[model samples]
Target: MSELAEPTVDPADWTCPAPLRDQPVVVMGHGGGGALSAELIEQVFAPAYGNATLAALTDSAVLDLGGARLAFSTDSYVVRPLFFPGGGLGDLAVNGTVNDLAMSGARPAYLSAAFVLEEGVELAVVEKVARAMGAAAEAAGVVVATGDTKVVESGHGDGVYVTTSGVGLVPAGVDIRPQRARPGDVVIVSGPIGLHGVAVMSVREGLEFGVEIASDTAPLADLVAAMLAVTPDIHVLRDPTRGGLGASLNEIARASGTGVRLSERSIPVPDAVANACGFLGLDPLYVANEGRLVAFVPPSAAEEVLAAMRAHPQGSGAAVIGECVAEHPGMVVVATGLGGTRVVDLPLGEQLPRIC
Candidate 1:
């Protein structure tokens, strides 16, 4: 090779990529759905005013209060455009917090909404968003028990941002947490991955794909109830929202001190999503999802839990994509269709911004 020739790249010798770690202040990646977000929590937030609940970092904090178990969570939505195919920010706000509670094997019961509005935004827009929230809560059979609103100067805020907090009851004999994942646990995903992120990007960025992809933003409380019916001993349930399946699984691996092995072919990626991600140099595994969940269950109850999941409307497309392993603890690996193995690491930064 001549001195002027370009260097060859080897995909096999992969390393987790990120910007230099010496950044003094904040960058977009700090809010991005990846390692930077986790770092912010671990390095800065967790160490201050911390408790065991935040340390676990599960979907929601399962608390034992007054002899009653409760799952509590909160989420804020700043999705650009406010509206997209299949849903809007209002619906996303309600469903996101509800799903977080549901992941803890709780039946979501009530939510509180708070809004931050820009000064120049129209009243009609706020009502439309509020109406959407009302309808979504009704559909999920949950209630918006309370709410508050405030306004910001036009330039200081998005048109509208919503924050929601929820509380739900956990049934007796039901315990679920990421740290409970074990070596023989079966890993299941509720449905196709990458739809919600792509749906938002396609509309917000005006990217053209042949077919329209809709966001998969729906509530999952009932679907969780179905799985609990099969066995109350289920180990882990995590919604693959920000940072997608890869980040969710990686978190579980680290929390449980176990390894995760996935089959490339078994992980479902819709053709449209795959093409869009490939063209954009994005990995669907690392994309965001609004309505999908990943579960870890003991081998003895894998089939029963899978069947229960598939029987629910929210889980009709559920599939077993991998298993918890004892090898390479704290890492995730995929066996490719071409007979090669590759490591899947928690993304160092967000691949797409404001995806959820």
Candidate 2:
């Protein structure tokens, strides 16, 4: 055989693939916890990190350290207006990370908060936020172990941005994750949805619905503990945060390769939220929630788990909204009140940005 010459390549010929290539720059959707967010992590961050733990893509990374299982998670809060109806940036920061750890069947124990403050921001504002953080940490039964502060030039940053990292211990025999969702599992939401997004929007836009909607920005570690008390075999747990219930269900379906079917009537949408969304031309399903969670439990244990959730204050509105199915794996379908079925795809981006 004749020898062949080596092929020549040009470095300038390279280009990023579709979606990301289309944008060519970071956009709000990249951080919206939607399809764009997933793509960014899968196409960019995941390959760069090249770790199996990160590949799992759970809300928190479960690590085995010194013969103990720990769940670690971090989140940043850049919510505008700083304060909202039931909570503010500080509590939101603490609760957000705590909830992420709790989703992995972990009992959150400690948190570290880092603050990025803008120059010329009032000292009283920082003090108020710090007090809120302290109170929220105490309420969640976690300590703010360590943190750092940095100041940015005026107008170069939001008044304040808080990033919180948390660690928690996962109990023995608990293995909660999205991939664990399976056909025949029952889906349940802890309570009414869309309040947090609407609450923030109402404040930001000064739009009033008939009744005031408060952000459901409470810690969910205790509620998760209560459900675990019922049974540790819970298949999956997700706190539908940035992308709301619709995005969360789609994520679970894709992760588990199972189809999720929801009942429109069964979903508990508060009247105030429904009215506000109607006025704003928004869907409640795509609105963000701070304290709510969606859980998948094996049918055999679903009733008891749901009962436990209901008995807890945070889950007083707990309802059976759906079930996982074998058909249409990796898709979510909802049965409408008018005898119709609609597919609920993962949102492309958040309807409300900087609300979390």
lDDT of each: 0.90, 0.93
- Candidate 1, residues 1-356: lDDT per residue as tens digits? 99997666564543444443444456667777578888878777788957667878888898889988989999889998899988999889989999999999999999999999999999999999999999999998899999999999989998999999999999999999989999999999999999998989899989889999999999998898999999999899999888889999999999999999999999989999999998889899988888889999999999999998888899999999999999999999999999999999988777887776
Off by over 4 Å in 1: 1-21
Per-residue lDDT over 212-239 for candidate 2, one digit per residue giving the tens place of the 0 to 100 score? 8899999999999999999999999999
Worst 10 residues of 2 by lDDT: 9-18
Q: lDDT of candidate 1 vs native?
A: 0.90
Residue 140's lDDT in candidate 1: 88
Q: Name the best candidate (by TM-score).
A: 2
